[model samples]
Target: MTNDPLKAAWQTANIPAHDDLQAVVRARGGHPVMSRIRRQLLLEGGCYILFLLVYYDFFDGHRRPLYLNIILVLSVACMLMQHLNGYLLASSALKGPDIFRSLQQKVLQLKQYAWLSVGSRVLGWCGIMVFFCTGITWTNAKYGLLAGAIIIMGVQMAMLWQLWQRRINRIKNTLAELNG
Candidate 1:
């Protein structure tokens, strides 16, 4: 009688499906971090758009050479696109047909995004510097200011790259665990 009741209880227990488990595992891909990053990207993208709207008047884009204006616009647009890409990437929920395959796909996507992020940062930095320094007659103080700005930009780039690498490494470690 005791064995019969215990078997009945065990048989009646609900178990989640494999697909449900896969969905849950994929959902664990940095929900909070993705949300926060997406929000930030939205805010920054908006600001960049607004800057583009007003730059001609406020920043004398009209006075700058055609090439300089083009460079600034292209750089800002590239950065904006990268920001949008980041937001979309974060929202991606599909892992793949299988967990390992999905993770491999994710790693590939992240590597591409990392390159885009760094490349856009460098391009935008260069574009802004060229646009702003175009008409300036080089002086000692101006040279000093430019040096300082370059140093600051370099540090910022290093920090951002480090952050990207850390996120990538975390995913790689997870993949390693699965593989091992």
Candidate 2:
């Protein structure tokens, strides 16, 4: 309200009103945390798309039961949708009102995705089990398939847990620093 000449001069100048300050903020690169989150989201989103391609190639027109195929495709689609949504959320955070609020939203988004990862793992395991039980009969060769599936599922779950923990902790650490 008072004395700075620069403030007085700026107040006296005729400047066009901005429709949204977000555009001005966005003209500059956003916060570092947002950049990191965006990169992670893009990488994961690309992986999901790649997974869908591979799944389609491997399973399409196969002897696999229709229900199993449907479930697998739907599951992949759901996972992809989640990743895409996360990516959009992360991108939007860059345009948020302030750095702290942006960070808070990013953390919330990461946490939500971490929980989604757990759900994705559970859904995958259940889908595999259901596929085996309902669609495939137990045969001599099927034992290998069952064993391989179990090993792969175990590895997948372990990796997912590690990834989830790492991502969540990274964001939490950033939040802690910001809060402190």
Candidate 3:
């Protein structure tokens, strides 16, 4: 095997050295999806924090029912927690004694978080909708508009599900290849 030209060629392939790879990783993060997740975490977390800061006065949260206010805040809290978990998972994707073990751990964690993430998003959306629509008398136009928003969020949920599927499958395939 050592003397075979094909084996030699494969063994000596021009993979980037560890430091160079690390530098690239530092520049762009591990995977594009992971980077996207991290970016989303920051963006969503920022927006949620902004809403928390301004909701009382700007959104008339002060005049809102105490239960509604609590529900809204709790929903936002769930969303923030979801984002934080995703960010942390993305950051730790490559951190382990070895790549295989690291990815294995990630897949496990991902499986565990899948429902939690989806549930949080759904809860947050429903909570926000409830909080916003509480005082509004629903006309045909209002119902139509709310229906449209609900449809949009439904599509978003499907897309998010697909993204999770892709991310998890890709990592699993990578792990399988490494095992061989």
Candidate 4:
């Protein structure tokens, strides 16, 4: 049978369907896994720009204070670790079931993503606090925080939107098959 256009689109985008995803997990050959890993790494690498912005806004003005320097270093490290963990999780094959086998894994992944989002926000807040405390006098702190929150929210929303679209398309396809 010819594939559904929506399924084709999803496959082209490398987002696997429920059954196809199981095959993808079992299949042991090809660049698809590596490509996914690379994509995630690229996404994670985006935090560097934020780091630079924080550095320029707070550190470049005057001699860096000890506390600010330490916090900056810790923030960068935490961001890196958070992204790396997410990359690993997303790249790995879903063992056993396509979805979580137990409530634990589901809760764990949710908590992991939540922590990453919260950690990012905390890092941004730290940058804002440092800027204020160091007498940098910047107006962008509130806007920056809002933008960061929006980004995190967007990630979750986009994932859910894709899933919802996929389900609707799948149901339409099944109906068409039954009618035809």
Candidate 5:
């Protein structure tokens, strides 16, 4: 009854450690999608932090409206939270036991993460929009920045949706196989 795709893939690849299944589990956690997510979190989180530091002047004075300041900061905070959740999920997946129950738990965590990611992206973008709308008097640059942000966020949302679908379906199928 050894119909496990991971096992089959390892055998087909001549990985030579079929008895040490935990190594295979560890290797699976290093999948490209997880790597991409980690890199994205690091890159975006770093850039956002840098942007805040560099633009602290714009946010600090008595000139800025409270709501605008709050919205702008909230947008960055939403992004940070989302990235942190993703990091935690990826780390947990790696630590999970090499068993069907662990796989099931990972699938559930992934489903939760997919929803959280979508919701956070929406909230973050909405905050950005509100910030731009409220701070129109602060700078004409708001319009250009909003437009660019929309395009970037749109592309990112699409990528995230695709990744979510691919990973979720893969895990669901694996779970189904284990259950069936």
Candidate 6:
């Protein structure tokens, strides 16, 4: 791996079409599997970040609503698990044997993460619904909605930025391989 930390990280984490496209391509036959894995990882990471934002915005301070707190806590846990699973998939995809095997493992891990993500989201959505239906003051409800929206956008942007960084590193690796 190159001395560049970002490049090295990308090389180890399997972000396709980055600096080391040639080696990555040669190693994996330019298979679509790598791209698919990358996309899935990005999506999962984005979702987790969004969930975190929602937790922070509304639940960070003040007396916690019992039902809302429980649901938020569970959602945060699930999101954390999903984030870890994504990182694992990225590392395994880069270093693991065959692309098929790597993908299989990624898919299995993703399945679990997906369930968690869905559950967490559901809990959050339901909590919001209940809060509104229970006739909570508009001020509280508005804050929750605002927080949720901010988190959604923030998480998406963060995930995309991470993906962009990986792509740049991959590009650098490709350049090095070509010149060498």
Question: Best candidate per TM-score, number?
Answer: 1
Flag the better candidate by TM-score, 1 or 6. Answer: 1
Candidate 3 on 1-180: residue-level lDDT in tens?
687999899998999888898789778756687778877878888999999999999999999999999999999998999889877766763668998998888888898788778889999999999999999988999999999999999999988888888889999999999999
TM-score of 4: 0.45
Which stretches of model 5 miss by more than 4 angstroms?
Answer: 1-37, 58-62, 93-98, 135-159
Question: Which rank order by TM-score, best down to worst?
Answer: 1, 3, 5, 2, 4, 6
Q: Using alpha carbons, what is the TM-score of model 2?
A: 0.56
Q: What's the lDDT for all of these models?
A: 0.88, 0.70, 0.88, 0.60, 0.78, 0.58
For candidate 4, lDDT tens digit of each residue in 45-134? 676656655675555634766667666566666666666776676555545443324333544555556556455646645664554466
Worst 10 residues of 3 by lDDT: 86-95
> Using Cα atoms with residue i matched to residue i, what is each candidate's TM-score against the true structure?
0.81, 0.56, 0.77, 0.45, 0.65, 0.34
Instruction: After superposing candidate 4 on the true structure, give the runs of residues whose Cα lies further than 4 Å from its correct spot.
Output: 1-37, 43-58, 96-104, 128-133, 137-180
Superposed by TM-score, candidate 1 places the C-alpha of residue 62 at a distance from the truth, in angstroms, of 1.5
Each model's Cα RMSD:
4.8, 6.5, 3.6, 10.4, 6.5, 13.9
Model 6 Cα shift for residue 121 (angstroms): 2.4
lDDT of 3 at 150: 98
Candidate 3 deviant stretches above 4 angstroms: 1-39, 93-101
For residues 46-149, write the lDDT of model 5, one tens digit per residue.
98888667655764424668777777788878878998998888866333566787887787888889989988988888886776565356556866887887
Per-residue lDDT of 120 in model 5: 90
Q: Is candidate 5 or candidate 6 better by lDDT?
A: 5
Q: For model 2, give the 10-residue run with minimal summed lDDT.
A: 55-64
Worst 10 residues of 5 by lDDT: 54-63
Candidate 2 or 5, higher TM-score? Answer: 5
Where in model 1 is the C-alpha error above 4 Å?
1-34
Give the clashing residue pairs of candidate 5, or none.
Answer: none
In candidate 1, what are the lDDT values of residues 58-124, reduced to their tens digit? Answer: 9999888899999999989988988888888878775788888888898889999998998898998
